[model samples]
Target chain A: MNALIIEKTEDSPGVKFDPATAQLSLSGESRPENAGKFYNPLLEWITQFESILFWRKEQKMDQKPLVFAFRLDYFNSTSAKYIMDIILTLNKLADKGYPIRVEWYYDERDEDMLDAGKEFAEMVQIKFDFLPN
Target chain B: MRHFNNPVIKIGAHETGKPYFSHTKHQHLHFSQNIMQDNNSLNAYEVHKFMSKMDILVAFTGHFDHQMITILLKNIRGKLKTTSPEMAIEQKVYCILVECVENVSKYSSGNEDSSRNGMFMLCKSDTKYTVITGNPMLNKDIPSLKAKLENVSKMSREELKQLYRQQIMSERETENNAGLGIIDIALKSGNQFHYNFKPLTETTSFYHFQTEIEINS
Candidate 1:
């Protein structure tokens, strides 16, 4: 699968999904005016990756465990909806017997961010590894 | 107490021999001379004192645009860093302020010039920091907006979480419960927010919204 990478902006988070490393990461702030424009591609990329995973499984290729790290300092509510979508999509991958791990990183001082991650994890019924920075 | 030496309105003759309002670093005023001379004229020094008394850290009233919101957020972030440097409180305050200002910039009806005009303020009391925003909107939106606010205001944290999830999962992104912003604000402020609608004209109303984040010392 081709990697998807986007640089971080003042109002958007950096996105990196590397098939080589089997890791997907989002970092920095996310408060874009049109969040769908920024996140829709990411969701599409994830769906594409799912297709690749299924193909690999069918071909009996090595299935690497995927890791998705979320290191968001801030994201507006509009972005939050997309974030939930991203998580739900990932959870679907997990449901399909694919090994998936979610790492939620937050500043130790930002309890609200931690709480938000917790809330998302609960909503998706996923046990996320909460890492405090 | 900090003293404001500069006057908000400096009354003086312009170089062209016409009386005009002079602005200082404290404030910019374009009121008529008669208004400036009124007993209720705003004095920057007095306003500064009043702000100090009310624990107001930041206030703005003007056209809200994307650039303006970015600048305001940067300024407020700096001010909060200096005035109330607690990380968690700062994040909550910043998040709520972003929502409030962005809400105004996005949803508020255009004024005479079709610009997004609104007012925003941040005040810190002994126990909490308050974010207030006011903007002009169509009167038709009041009933639905009021109901949303009332419903969200009455929800507990758990209920808010559920609503947030439902809104995100809803098929219609732009319809009812599109109040993801309000729910987010309520959740961030620990479920403490107030809102009001003031009738401005037959077709429009002034919307006032306030959110508070507790200062845990």
Candidate 2:
């Protein structure tokens, strides 16, 4: 599968997902005017990636588990909802026997962000790591 | 003038080249009415008028929603761009507005019928810029609200940051809303949040919050 990498901006964040490396990362501010537009594509990519993994298993293609790391410094209300959606999707994938790890990183001084990560962790069955930067 | 069971105060027009009045409810009401009327779209012009009329603006009128907040923020940014043009001041005002409006959108309890059910206002003067927001909150939530505000008020800058970080690490998250917006407001404003709760009924209270950011320039 081809890799998808998008850089962060003043108004948006950066996204990096390399199927070959199995390393996915999202970082920066995410308060876009139209959050749905920004997130729909990412959601689609994740779904396709999951499908590819599933197909690979059926065909006996050697595959390695993917590691998803979410590092958001600041995200608005709209983006928060989508992020939750992404986490839930990942949890489902993990439940289906896909090796996945979710890491929530926030600044050491940003207690609110830390609490946010904790809150999302409780909702899904996926193992979530809360790291202080 | 129209009168309602609730007391309404009105102040006269602004005095050119004169010091703006503070702590006067009438002035705020009058200024708000004029701004609302003049800016048919409630665009940047109205925000500019609002900033010019008051030294500290605290509006908690029930006219904010998601769409309205977008427009309000745009207008406020426009006003800041045209007037001060300082990045820091612009950020301060923007953060205060975000906190105030997000609270209203999250907690406003009035049903669909009441067009102006929440409280929203902006105040500004030479020394400070203030935003006051009011929304209907459940009576049961009052204690927690009070506690949070009290805790926030007591924290030093470093302590607040630590607390913010701690909250970030907690594993419990709300689906669509997080109370972090208020914390962001406090941090950006560098002021103690001023708030009051007036009972609207046995089940609900009008939660009022006022936050201010000083303008050193």
Candidate 3:
């Protein structure tokens, strides 16, 4: 599958999803004026990749485990909802037995970010590796 | 503390000679020169002292626009790093400020006759920081804004999470940030949302909102 990459901006986060490398990640701050416009493409790309991902796994051709890393220092609540959506989609794929794991990184000093990641970890079905930076 | 209905113009020492008030034909005086000259009592140094006593860190009042938002956020981020000891508290404060500013900017009527004017301030009180924002908006937007604020304010932590999830999954087009900005502020501030609306004119009103976040020591 083709990789989907979104460059970083002052008001948005950078997104990279490469099925080839089994790497999916989002980093930086996310406080966009219009969350829908910014996150819509990211969601659509993930959905497209999900279909191909499941189909590839069905063919018994699973190469490497997928890694989803979230390294956001600051994301408004609206952006948090979008992040949850991404996680939910990924968890559904994980449920299908496609090897996947989520890695959440936060600064050791940033308790709110850490708590947010932990909260999402508890709310979702998949377990997350909370890495403190 | 003083609320104003009409546009209050304060002429600085530099613009002293120019007519502060404008009239097409008649230059009839309304308030009087005595009140106009009373601004000599309003000293910038005294105002700074008062603001300092209240630990006022950031304050701005003007038109709300995209460029202004960016500049304000950048200034807040820089200021918070020095004032706040913990990164977590700084981040939370920044988040709340962003929401407040965005909310004010997003819903502002921006009418041609009377453009949307806004005021934003951040003050420190003991172990908490308060964000206060006010803007001129159409009176019609009040009901929906009130309903959303009341709903979020009433929700428990768990309920708020569920609502957030449902809203995102439904792909609803919100007024701003999918109407999730206010909810996010409430949740982060531990449900500290105080809002009021003052009638400014027949169709316009001034909306004031304040939220407090506990400074993590």
Ranking by lDDT: 1, 3, 2
Candidate numbers sorted by DockQ from highest down: 1, 3, 2
Worst 10 residues of 2 chain B by lDDT: B2-11
For every model in order, the TM-score on chain A comes to 0.94, 0.92, 0.92
Q: Considering the two chains of model 3, state its CAPRI-style docking category.
A: medium
- Chain B TM-score, model 1, reads 0.77
Tens-place lDDT per residue, model 3, B32-73, is 232333545444554565456446688887887776788779
Computed on alpha carbons, the lDDT of every model, listed in order, comes to: 0.78, 0.67, 0.74
Question: Of 1 and 3, which scores higher on DockQ?
Answer: 1
Going through the candidates in order, their DockQ values are 0.58, 0.11, 0.58
Instruction: Output the number of the lDDT-best candidate.
Output: 1
Model 2: which docking level applies? incorrect
What are the per-residue Cα lDDT tens digits for candidate 2 across B88-133? 6666676567767776666666446543357566666556666777
Comparing only chain B with the true structure, the TM-scores of all models are 0.77, 0.70, 0.78
CAPRI tier of model 1: medium
Tens digit of per-residue lDDT, candidate 3, span A1-133:
6788889888889989897887989999897777778888887887787777777767878558778999897887678778888888888878877777899999998777887788788767787999986
Q: True-contact fraction for model 3?
A: 0.62
Backbone clash numbers for all candidates listed:
0, 39, 0
Local error of candidate 2 at A76, Å? 3.0
